[model samples]
Target chain A: MEALVASAVAVMTAVGVYLILRRQTFPVVLGMAMLSYAVNVFLFATGRLVVNMPPVLSDTATGYTDPLPQALVLTAIVISFAMTAVVVLLALGSFIASGNDGIDLGEDRE
Target chain B: MNHWIIAPVVLPALLAPLLVLLARNDLRAQRMLSGAGTVGFAVLAAVLLVQASAGGIGVYRLGDWPAPFGIVLVADRLATLMLALTAALALAVLVHVISTGWDARGRHFHALYQFQLMGLAGAFLTGDAFNLFVFFEVLLIASYGLMIHGGGRARLRAGVQYVVMNLAGSVLFLFALGTIYAVTGTLNMADLALKAAAVPAAEAGLLRVGGVLLLMVFAIKAALVPLQFWLPATYASAPGPVAALFAILTKVGVYAILRMVTLVFGAGSPAGDIAGALLLPAAGVTLMLGMIGVLGARDLGRMAAFAVIGSVGTLMLGVAIFTPAATGAALFYLIHSTLVAGAMFLVADLVRGQRGGLLLAPGPRMANHGMLAALFFVVAIGVAGMPPLPGFLGKLLILDAARSAPTAWAIWAAILVGSLLAVAGLARAGAAIFWATNDDASPVPSQPLALAGVAGLLVALAALTVAAGPVSGWLNATAEALYAPAPYIAAVLGGGAP
Candidate 1:
């Protein structure tokens, strides 16, 4: 299970980096979204991937999963969602103002 | 468990939402409320500084939960000093924005400004790493709104770049946090400090990786070389008051580096040494590159932006040395640079308003050319680390502290040469804007209150100079407290020593 999760994070991060390197705004935003997902999963896996265990502690349990990472991941998700929304709006504004979505400033490119 | 420790974070947090909900359409009311909140925040910061000066740590835990399990805000000498600086800067920037009517350019300016304060205060005070990340986002998103507040094409372009780059940095922040948590099983800094010393030899590699990644995140925020590409465009294009407020933002990065590196990973640790190794050379290069940028700049605004990057390098050079004397000097330099940088940005705006733009080419003399020239000259001398100003004293302290460093000569040469280059750049800009002759005869009218705001900052710098004896004493104690983190840990954990 740990191996699977690790490999998934690696693949997502690789794809995200590739897309982020592209010159267009849309691709870069998508790339950020992908990278954020990868980060979220990686944060979640920090608790070491326990299965069939409750996050809560009680008097009569064999063991329980660490609940802190779950909480951390949830917070990260909301923050990333807000971040993505803002970036999209910024990209749209830039596109409307300059009529191009390339990452470089128009004059600086030349 | 003193509750006032949380006031800096809570006051602004509550006021921001109230401004948005209650005074959304009423600019005058919004201003009154924000002004009141900022004044109250300043008072609270003063009280905190006084309390901290008496020498004890104040830790406030949420919901009566114990240290390692709950959210906590720690107020020590360092946090209080930063809080005081932020409040003072916010008040100055507020007056400038109100006087110049910069807030009227957009909706929700007051709300966003207050939110930005909340974020900065929280980032400074929070004891948990995850909470720090949350506040980082708060400050950053508000900054995005503030950066493009006036909404020009140039601003929008710069805002996009700033947003994208910071988002990347945030992702890296999460990765670093994950690695640290995975290795240590805790995120509360005091708890981590205790655990760090006990980490198994086998897990040392992971800890070093996490530490390096964290340093990189901070370096990006501080705009260190190679990672600083976004700063010139962003700061140059941001509205003047917004840019002034942002002078504190990079310091947030430096503040985090000082706090985390000293407390959680101090000397004798591989992670600390590795971070130091990375910071020193990078800071030297950043200093040289920032000077080059300053010389190459064609506009007053961009030159000030590059100078900010240069000051960050100087601050980090002190941090990289990581000695008590050096950190103390860095703290002093930190305060001086933030105020001076804010003043420089405002001066840029003043020149823009008077001369119709900030471009370097000769034009008609400004209406208040003589007064503005004097102001510019004083501020330029302060920024270039000339005599009789706090800037010179701060730089001298840093240079004095660096003598014992292994690479003292290199650091000294970089800083001395950087100061000379900066003086030349500012001199050139001053000449271009003030002394050169042009055909146009009309002088731009100046606003009195905005001028007062700039003068207020200048007065603050002067105050710093006059009080250098007491202030340096305070900074030295703060550095002592930081280097001896056992008291901080004990205070947070409710146990030994403190």
Candidate 2:
């Protein structure tokens, strides 16, 4: 399970970096969204990939998973979601205004 | 728990929404509310400064929760000093935005400005790593709105690049935080300090990776070399007052480095001042490249942007030394650079207003050409680290502080050459804008009130220069407290060992 989760994160991050290096706004935005998802999953796995255990510590239970990562992941998800929305809107605005999806400023680009 | 510890953050958090909801359609009301809120904020920061200077760390725990368990807002000398600087810069930026009617060119300028302040203040005050990330996003999102305020095609395109670059940096930040948390099991900075200091040899590699990744994120923000590609375009295209306010943004990254190095990753930590080894060389290159860019820029706005990058490079050199005296000197330079950079941007904007654009070519003789030239001259001296300004004093202090470092000679050479390039750049731009003029066109009339904001910041810089002794004395104490994090940890965690 741990290997699977780690490989998933690695693959997503690789894909994200590749897409982000592209010059177009749509691909860049999509890359950021993909990266955020990979980070979210990686953050959740910081608790050591526990399953079927309570998040909170209790005397009755045999053990509990670390709950802090769960909370941290939740906040990270919301922020990344909001940030993705903003980037999408900005990408759309740039496209409509300039009539091109290229991200670079005009002077240096060939 | 002094309530004032949270007031800097709370004041803007409350006022921003009020401006958005109540003063949405009322520009005058937005102006009045934002102006008044900022004034109140300045007063609050001053009060916090006094409270902090009394020589004990103040920790305000949310919901009465204990440290390492819940969020805490810390008011230490370093945090409070940053708060004061933010308040002063915000006030000056507000004056410029309102007096020049720059806010009227866009929707929700006032609300966004307040949100930006809230984010900056919160970022300075928070004691947890994850909370810092949240505040970073807050400030970054607000800055995106402000960046394209008076949107043009170029500005919007620049904004997209800026946003995308920072998003990548943010992802890196999260990954670093996750790695650190997975190893240390704590995100509270003070607790992280304790855990990091004692991490077993087996886990040290992961911790070091996390630390280096974190440093890279900060390096991106600080505009250090190889990661500085986003700054010039974004700053040049951002609205004048917004660009001026952004003078504090790079300092935020520097502040985080100082905090992390001294408090969490000091000599005892397994990572052991990870930024220390990397910052010095990167800073030297960053300085030279930035100054070269300044010399090569074709417009006043882009020139000022490069100057900002160069100043950050110099500031990071001071941080890389990690000695208490060097840290104190870095603080001095931090204040000087923030004020002077803001002044440069403002001067650029004023020149643009009179000359019809920021381009360097001669045009109409502007009204009060002599006065504008004088303002630019002082800013030029400050940027170039020439005598008689606080910039020179700040650089002298840093050089003096680096006397014992192994790479002192290289650092000095970088700064001196960088200063020369900056001076040449500013001199050429000044001559082209103010001295080289077309006599055929009538002199453009610039509002005297617009000069008020620029003059106010210059006055502040003058005041900083005059009060250098007392100010450095205070920063020395701040640096002392930073290097000795035991008191800070005790204050937050209520005096207990891990």
Candidate 3:
């Protein structure tokens, strides 16, 4: 399970990095979204990936999984969602104003 | 148990939403509320500063939970001093924006400004690592709104770059946090400090990787050399008051570096030593590159932006030394640089308004050229670390502290030469703006309130100079507190072994 999670994160990060290097704004935004997903997964996996276990204690069970990583991941997911929304609007605004999807500035064109 | 430690964060947080809902369309009311709130904040910060300097470390835990399990806000001398500086800077920038009517240019300016203040205060006061990241996003998103507040092509372009770069840095922050948490099973700074030294030898590699990644995140935020490509464009393009407020943003990076390094990885730790060794050379290069950027700048705003980057480099140089005296000097320099950089940005706006542009070429004579020229000269001298100002004293302290370090000579040469180059670059810009003859253009009228804001900041700089003796003593004590994490650790973890 850990191996699977690790490989998934690696693949997502690789693709995200590749897309982020693209010149188009939409792709870069997509890239960031992908990267954030990778990060969230990585954070989630920090609790050692226990299966068939509750995240709470009820005084009946011998043990339970660490719930902190789950909480952290949830917070990260919400923040990254907000980040993506903001970036999308910004990129869209920039595209509409300049009539181009390229991220380069006017001076850089010259 | 003190509630005041949380007020700096809570007041702004509550006021921001109220401004958005209650005073959305009422600009006058919005300004009044924000101004009042900021003044209140400043007063609170001053009180906190007094309390902290008197050797009180206030730790407020949310829901009255124990330290390692709950969100906490720690206000020692260092945090309160930073809080005070942030409040003071926010007040000045608020006045400037109100005076210049810069807030009218964008939607939700008051709300965003208040939120930005909340984020800064929260970041400075929060004792939990994850909460710091949350506050970072709060400040960052607000800054993105403010950066393009005026809505121009240049701002849009720069704003996109700035947002994307910081987003990447945020991801890095998450990864670092994950690594640290996985290795140590805790995120509370004091708890981490206790656990950091006990990390098993087998996990040392992971800890070092996490430490380095965290440093890189801060390095990006501080705009150190390779990671600084976005700063010049962003700062130069942002609205005047927004740029001015951002003067403290980079210091947030430096503040985090100092806090984390001193608490979690103090001197004598292998990770601490490695981070310091890495930071010194990078700081030197950042200083050199920033000076070159200053010299090569084509406009006053861009020059000011580069000078800010250079100042960060200088602050980091002192930080790299990792001595109490050096850290104290860095703290002093940190305060001075934030003021001078903010003043420079405001001055850039004044100059830009007068000449109708910030370009380096000779322009028409300003209406009040003499007064503006004097302001420029004094601010320039301060920024370049010349005499009769706090900047000079801060630099002397840093240089004096560095004399005992192994790279003392290199640090000395870089700072001295950097100051000289800054002077030359600023002088050239000053001469072109104020001295050169151009008869075709009419003088631009100055805004009284805006001028007052700039003058107010200059007065604060002067106050910093006059109060240097007591201020340095406080900072020295703060530095001592930072190096001796026993008090901090005990306060956070209920008097456990440090």
lDDT of each: 0.90, 0.91, 0.89
lDDT sort, best first:
2, 1, 3
| RMSD of model 2 against the true structure | 1.8
- Candidate 3 backbone collisions, by pair: none
lDDT of 1 by residue, B212-321 (tens): 89988988999998799999999999998899899999999999999999977777664547867889999999988888778889999999999999999888998889
Q: Score every model by TM-score.
A: 0.98, 0.98, 0.98
How does residue B125 of candidate 3 score in lDDT?
91
TM-score (C-alpha) between model 3 and the true structure = 0.98
lDDT of 2 by residue, B367-411 (tens): 888898999999899888887889999999999999999999998
Q: Compose the digit string of candidate 2's lDDT tens values, residues A1-110.
A: 99999999999999999999999988888899899999999999998987788887777888789899889889989998998899899989988988999987867420
Query: In candidate 1, residue B77 scores what lDDT?
Result: 92
Name model 2 segments beyond 4 Å from true. Answer: A108-110, B442-444, B495-498
What are the C-alpha RMSDs, in order, of all predicted structures? Answer: 1.7, 1.8, 1.8
Residue B45 displacement (Å), model 3: 0.8
Ranking by DockQ: 2, 3, 1
Q: DockQ: which is higher, 2 or 3? A: 2
